[model samples]
Target chain A: MVIKVENLTKRYGDLIALDNFNLEVNHGEIFGLLGPNGSGKTTAINCILSLLKYDKGTVKIYNKPMAPDAYDIKEKIGLVMQNVAVFEELTVYENVDYFCGLYIKNKKLRLKLVEEAIDFVGISYYKDFYPKMLSGGLLRRLNIACGIAHQPKLIIFDEPTVAVDPQSRINILEGIQKLNKAGATIIYTSHYMEEVEQICTRIGIMDKGRIIAIGTKEELKDMISSGEKITVELFSMDNKILEDIKGLPHIVSAEYRDNSLIVRSSKGKNNLVSVLDYLKSNDIDFGRIYSEPPTLNDVFLEITGKELRD
Target chain B: MFLHNYIYRLKCIIRDKEFLFWTLLFPIILATLFNFAFSNITEAEKFTRLNIAVVDNEEFRQNTALQRAIKAAANSSGDKDQEGLFNIRYTSKEEGDKLLEDREIEGYIYLDNGIKLVVKESGLSQSIIKGFMDHFMQLSSTLETIIRKDPQSMERGILDKAEAAINYLKEVAPSKSSPDIVVNYFYNLIAMACMYGGFWGLKEVTVIQANLSSQGARINIAPIHKFKIFIVCVLAAVTVQLFEILLLLAYLALVLKISFGNQIGYIIFTCIVGTITGVTFGAFVASVVKKGEGVKIGILIGSSMTMSFLAGMMYDKMKYIISTKVPVIGYLNPANLITDCFYSLYYYGINTRFFINIGVLCVFIVFFSLCTYLILRRQKYASL
Candidate 1:
């Protein structure tokens, strides 16, 4: 395991930021912590990195205890914070070089690594520009380059794509994947479920400072009773038809509104086909149909009885 | 690693226009303005002969002793190179009154029961005339007592001894430099500049503490020890601040033609100590205050300016007043100590007082540095 956190507890005055938080990230696994705002994702990360003092628990990296002064363990960890963290007075190249120099003492090797990190982030064209001269996306890229220039064994990215444009978000996600492919264990945190779902091999759903669920995407989805959701557009639909759809096999709920029939089913195959067959036997003509597989949102809603974003 | 951190820190500080403006350019501008405002006042302070009209009447002619004393003062025979203290125009009593009224002379001296000095107003020149007359009266009274007690004492050269005593009190240069009171303003200006070095120190501290900034958070996770980074950044801040102080010093001494004395080595040493004190003081404030960067900066500026003001940055006499009335503040205030270091160097030329100021500054530096270390030694924050 690259990171092992057990029974971690932290409090700020009266509020518990983290309670019995336990986590284990394996080598070469991209672990994602998915939560809403103020869900203790940042607090857990800070505690794991030994940047924050916790009330109780232990954090270990590579099977050794982690601490503020654990340079050996810290040497293998890279952190890209939620906020952009680069010197405004320094150019992109110098910012990267300075941070890279902190870990890699060899000047020649440091120079090579800094350049490679800048290129990896695809900001080579703006390397000579100061941070203030760059746009938000470019600045975030520089922030990432500064964190990962030394190429540590484990890289932690905390909401790296917040407020970024769609194109830059795609680029950043792809870059993170590439970094993971190069054999680095990654810990990613975000409130955006889509982001966590798209790139995370395994996801941990966090709420109120505790991990509510943790598993692969498929496993997490299987843990919930809700499955695929099918929506059919119709010219008109009555309450009788909605009731009939609800009575169908594997159908958990059915509702008709705004000239569309929406049906949610339990975990089962051919749920969509069954809904269509019912509609056809009833001689109801549908204009359009959409069948979406159970998403992380559905899994969170089924488990928590609330929206993932809420 | 040290060199890399140090070099980058230096670059960041040097490129910071706000720090450079306050620590370097602002002092130069204020010094220039001080020079322009005080140039005439300094020139006017040069000693000029006081004009007086002595009543040439029966009492003055009969009192030959007073006559000879006044004549000696009017002539520059006491010191060959020095100018006479008084310019006497012998006239009748009525004419003397006219000269005083017309403001052609500072005052007029006439012997009634004794020598009496009359002036239009109280001023330096009028006060000098009064002082001279009073001294002569006291001397005459002393001589009369000596003769009455033992007339042979006069033949023993007591009169000549008294004359020699009077000459001993003549104005003399304390050192090989102009005792221009305006120079204190420049010293205070330099002290204020030194205090402004706290900005760089504050920046260094804010950048290193995880609770203060995102950059700080990023650095706390780095592989290197926190103290290593702090020391490196502080060294860089000191380097940049020292350079700025030297530049300001050069502008004041070489360009503004202000005399900070000829003790070049000691002056630079004081600058170094003062720069360290400023930076360390800033770091101490930043560490102790659990506030945002803006609030910390506000506190630093307010405290530094207050210290500078107490040290006579705004009012020249305030330093003297504080030192005399509130000696503890003079001893404790780094700005006051730094200013006094320069003042002592210029006037006393590396005396005990100069060393005392330097020593006090060293104490301040140690105290601030220790406090900052104590506060920052905690590697992990309770919150960020």
Candidate 2:
């Protein structure tokens, strides 16, 4: 294991943020910590980084105790927190250079790395612009560049894609995969289930400050009883028809909204056909339908019970 | 790591241009304005007369010596000789009283049994005139006795002096009475101006902390220690502040012809220390308070004003109140210390406890600095 967080616990006065949380991230794997809002994702990360004073925990990075002044250990780990941490005064290139300078002392080498980091984020045109002048996405890219420019062995990106446009989000995901390919152990956290499914090799889903389940995407799908979600767009969804569909044998649950009904069921068998037959018998006009296999959303819903957002 | 942090901090300061202007430039401009406004004479100008009023209720009118003194006052060459500087006018007792009440003259001298100076207040020019007249009375009395003793010509000596002066005034061009105190203010004036504001802690409170354009958030992270960052910033800020001090001082020296002192190194050192003290106090303030740009400004204005007030920078209208009631604040205020230090250096060739002043201010700087560093080190991104 490259990173070991053992029996981690933290509290704020009377409120408990994390409780006996244990996690291990091995080298050469994109590990994901998925959680809802206020589910101690940030708390755990902070404790691991020794940014917060955890009441009880032993965070071993590269198999040694972690403390703030442990510059040798801190040297190999990079953190891009949820908040953008670039200096508002510095231009894009300068921001990257400054942070990289913390680890890399050689000026010529640091300059090359800084330039590559800027270009890698597709923000070369904004290399001279100050952080205040850049748009939100551009600033986010700058934040990532600052964190990853030092080129640490282990990189932790906490919700790096939040509030970014789709194009930027795609670019960020691609960059993360590239960073992993370059032999960086990545710890990625996000509530976006599809993003986790798309990139994370193994995901740990947490709730109420505990990891309820951890496995590959397919393995997590196997863990959850609900295998697939069928969403039907309906022209007219009658109250009795919706009730009758819910009463159907293999149907798990049905929700009607925006002229659509979402039917979820365990047993990946074709329940959509049976539901469509019932809808036809009931003379309900429906639009297109989409059947997505059990995503991380299904895995999250199964373990947490409540929706991840609540 | 040090170089990285340094570059990053430099960048931050550069990006925040509005902050730079307010913190660095604003206080300087305000100080310059105060310097010029409070100055009695920023430049040399044409000579003017000292207005004096006389109300003599004596039955001693035919005193030729007194008449001669009065007439010759207009034509006397200089105040040092007690004959040339007064604009004398005689009025009735009631008229003098009314004129005093109406502020028509600075004061009036009444010569009865003894001389009495009647005015709203005693000022510098008034005291100088009072001394001159006292001497003139005795000199006239002396000259009168000498002439009386000769038994040759029955002439009062003052009458002869006055007649001769009046006759000379008709033939010769006038001369100015330049007082020694007025002409001798070139001593350590530069060091005093530069050393006071910074030593007083007004610049820090007013400029760096109060300028809202400089954000505190950008610095809390960035993988660098706060103290090193602080050192860089303080060094940078003081360098600018001391340069401004030097600029104003040079303008005064080269242009206004003001001199600080003979000991050039010590004078400049005093200014440098004062600048550092100001920058340190500013950093300390920034550490303690959040949302303090306005409060910092308030302190800046209030501090410079109060320091100037206590240091006798303006009219000494509140000297009685400041000296007696609030002796501690008035006597020990840094600007008072700085100004007095320079004054002592110039007058007595003494440097009073420069080490002590620096040590005391360093205590404040360290105490506040440690607190600020602890607070910054424990910074939080969220409200918690």
Candidate 3:
């Protein structure tokens, strides 16, 4: 395992921030911590990074206990915080060079790494620009460059693309994938489920300061009763037709609303074809139809009630 | 790594306009204002020879003791060319009245019963003439009592003591150079400038504490030792502040024609210690105050200005009052120590008092810096 956090518990006053949170991220994989805004995703990351005090637990990185003074571990770790943390007074190049110099003391090596980081983030054009002068997207890019300039083996990105533009978000996600491909273990966290579903090799869903579920995207979806969501555009639909469609094999729910039929099915093969055949046999006319496999959002909603969002 | 941190911190501080304005431009501007406000006041206080007119009468000519006292007060320098406490003009009574009316003589003395003094205006010169007459009368009375009590001992020590009394009044001559009152403003200016170094110190502390800023959290996550980071940043800040102080000193000495005496080494040493104390004080405040950076900055400015005020930056006589009334505060205040360092060097020469001031400032620097180190040595924060 690249990073292992076992039985972590942290409390803030009367509120429990992390309740026995356990996670194990393997080498050369993108592990995403998915949750809502106050679901202890950041609290868990902070505990693992040893940035916050935990009541009970152990965080081990590279098979060694993590600590504040563990230079051997810290030197090989890169952290891109949720907020932009680059210096406002220093230019992009200088900011990158300064953070890089923390790990790489040699001036020449630091200069090279800084240049590479700026180039990797595609912010080479704004190397001389101060952070205040850059737009939000460019500033976030600079923040990433400052964090990753040293080319650490274990990188943690806490919501790297929270409010980024689409193009910049794509660049950041692609850069993260490229870094993992370059032999780094990445730990990603975000409340946006699609981003995690797109990049994460293994995922953990957290709520109320605990990881409620952890598995691959397919496994997480399978853990819930939702299989596929099929929606059809209809010209006309009767109430008896909808009840008959609900009676089909593996049909968990079927409803007709706004001149359309929506069918939610359980785990089964050819559920969409069975539903279409039942609709045709009833002489029900349908327009365009869409069949979407169960998403991470469905799994989250099924496992934790939607009321958990604050 | 230390050198790298130092260099980058220096670059950042140099680029910071707020630091530049506070530590450099503000002092220069304040000094300029002080210079303008104190111009006429200082000119008026310069030492000038006092003019006096004495009536030429039989009583004045016959009384040798009175003649000697008047001569001692007038020709204090014992030289005809140099000016003294009084420029005496012996003239008729009518002419003396005319001279007093014309403001040619500040006052006139007439020997009527014992001695009488007249003046058109009551001022320092008139007061000096009255003081001279009083001393002569007292000496004459003492001599009479000594002769009456023991005529034999009158020749032993009474005449010598009376002669010493006449010599004491003659010591107030134009021998020593007049003290410059305006230099106190610049001395306190340097003190205030040194205290401004705390702002940079506060910035350094806020940049390293995880609870303070996001940049602080980012830095805390780095592999470097926290103490090493603190040391390098403090050194860098002190260096930058010292440079700012040097620029202010140069502006005062060269541009404003303010004199800091000829003791170049002591002046530079005072600034070095003053800057260190300032930065260290700022760091101490940053560590102790659990509030935001804005609150820490407010405390630093408020306390520094208060100390500067007590050191007489606002009014010159306040320092003297504080030194006499609240001597403990005078010794404890860093601004007072700094102002006294320059004051002692210029007026009293390099002596034990100057060294004591330097020593006290060193103690303050070490005390504050040690408190900051104890608070910052921890690598992990309780809450980020």
Candidate 4:
């Protein structure tokens, strides 16, 4: 494992920020800690990074205990904090170079890596601009550049796209995927399920300082009692046909409203095909149809009994 | 790693116009204002002549030696518009008394059986007039002794010695010039400027504490020893602050023409120690106080200003009063220590007092720095 956290517990006064939070990220994978705000995602990351004091448990990186003085382990880990943490006084190039110089002592190689990191984040054109002079998206990019300039083996991104524009968010997600492909194990955290679903190799859904579920997208979706949702556009739907669809195997619920017939399946391989065959057999005229397997949001909603963003 | 941190820290501080304004421009502006405000007072003390009246009485007419001495004292030295020792107005006793009472003349000479100096009140002019009278009395008494002991040897050199004693007394009177009070303002200003280094120190603290800033959080997770970063950043802060103070000193000495005596090495030592103490104190405050950045900054500024106020930055006499009233606080206050260091340098030669001030500052630097290190050495924070 690149990063392993076991039974981590942290408290702030009377409130427990992280309760027995456990996480493990393997090498060459983007492990996503998906949660809403205040779900202890950042707390867990902070504890693992040795930036916070935990009341219980231990954090290990590369099979060694993590500590403030774990320079050898820390050298292989890059952290992009939840907040923009670049020096406002430094230009983009200087900020990246300064942070990169922290790990890579060789001046020539640090310069090369700094340039590459800036280019990777697509912020080379704004290299001369200070953080304050850049737009929020560009600033976020610079923040990422500074963190990853040294090209550490394990990169932890804590909600790096929180306030970024949509385009920048896409670029950031792609950059993270690129980093993973380039052999850096990634630990990504965000409240946005779609981003995690798009890039994360395995997902851990957390709520109230505990991981509710952890698996690949397919495995997580299977864990829930909901599967592909089939929506068919219908000019008219009979109540008898809706009843018949509900009686079909694995059809959790079937409803007809506003010229559309919707069918939700609990678990089945061909729920959509069965619904379509039934529709045709009954000679129901449909305009359009859509079958979407359960989304990470759906899995999160089913497991948590609340909206992912709520 | 140390070089990188120091260079980046230097860049961050130098590019911050706000820091430059407080550390550099503000002191220079205050020094200029002090120069203008105290110009007249300092010049008057240094060069202005006193006004006096002499009574026209039998004692004065018969005292030929006294009359000749007064005439010589009244003659101008022919320097650019500078007046003599006294602007004398010979008048009757009633007129002279009226002049003294009306405050037109500082004092007057009352020639009677024996000469009596008359003044309504005591001040620099009154003191100078009294000094002259005392000098004349001593000379006349000595002459009387010489004449009584050996009347023939009196012409050998007694008169010449009396003249020399009279000239010597002339330099001791109003012309002697009191210590310049305006330099106290400049001294206090340098003290305030050095304490302003606390801002840089506070910035260093906030930047290294993960709970205080995102930059701090980012730094804490870096693969470097926390103490190394702390030392490097603090050195950078001191370097920037010391440079700013040196510039302020240059502005005072070169541009404003303020004198700080000739002890250049000691003055530099005092400034360096003061800067380090200010910054170290700031780091200590930042470490101990778990408040937000704004509150920490407010505390630093409030404490620095309060200390500067007590050090007599606004009213020079307050420093003396505090020293006499609450002497412990006077020594404890870094601003007071810095001001006193400059004060000792300006007034006295390099002596025990100056070294004592410098030693106290070094103690402060070490004590507060150790406290800061003790508080900050552990990198793990309760929260972030």
**Which candidate leads in TM-score?**
1
Cα-based TM-score, every candidate: 0.88, 0.76, 0.85, 0.85
| Stretches > 4 Å off in candidate 4 | A232-249, A254-262, A269-287, B44-73, B76-178
Q: Lowest lDDT 10-mer window, candidate 2 chain A?
A: A81-90
Superposed Cα deviation of residue B362, candidate 3 (Å): 2.1
Write the residue-wise lDDT of candidate 4 on A1-310 in tens digits: 8878889999998898888988888889999999989999999998898888899998999999999988999899899987999888999999999888889889999999999999999998999998889999998999999899999999999999988999999999999999999999999999999899999999999999999999998899888889889989999866788889999999999888888888899977889889989989988788899998889888988988898989
Per-chain TM-score of chain A in candidate 1 equals 0.98
Query: Across residues B114-205, which tens digit of lDDT does each residue of candidate 1 receive?
Result: 77888889988888888898889899998999999999998999877776655446678898886778898899889888999999999999
Ranking by TM-score: 1, 4, 3, 2
Q: CA lDDT of each candidate?
A: 0.90, 0.68, 0.88, 0.88
- Model 2, B1-384: lDDT tens digits are 555554555445444565555544554464455456536653444345667778755533645456566666667555563446678778888888888788777788776675567777888667867776786777767666867777565443444554453443343322222222321222223323443333223322222221222123223323445456556665555666576666655665575555455656766766666566555555655555565456755554466556656656554434346657886764456555555445544444434455555555456557655765675555332222
Which of the CAPRI classes, incorrect, acceptable, medium or high, describes model 4? medium
> How many Å off is the CA of A19 in candidate 1?
1.4
Tens-digit lDDT string for candidate 2 (A82-183): 878766656788778877886787889999999999989999999888788988888888888988887889998999988999888999999999999999
Candidate 4 residue-wise lDDT, B215-319, digit = tens: 888888888888888899889999999999999898888988888888788889889998998888888888888888789888988998899999998888899
Ranking by lDDT: 1, 3, 4, 2
**Alpha-carbon shift of residue B210 in model 4 (angstroms):** 1.4
Candidate 1 Cα errors over 4 Å, as ranges? A281-283, B47-174
What DockQ does each listed candidate score? 0.74, 0.39, 0.56, 0.70
- List runs of model 3 lying over 4 Å from the truth: A234-249, A254-261, A274-286, A307-310, B46-178
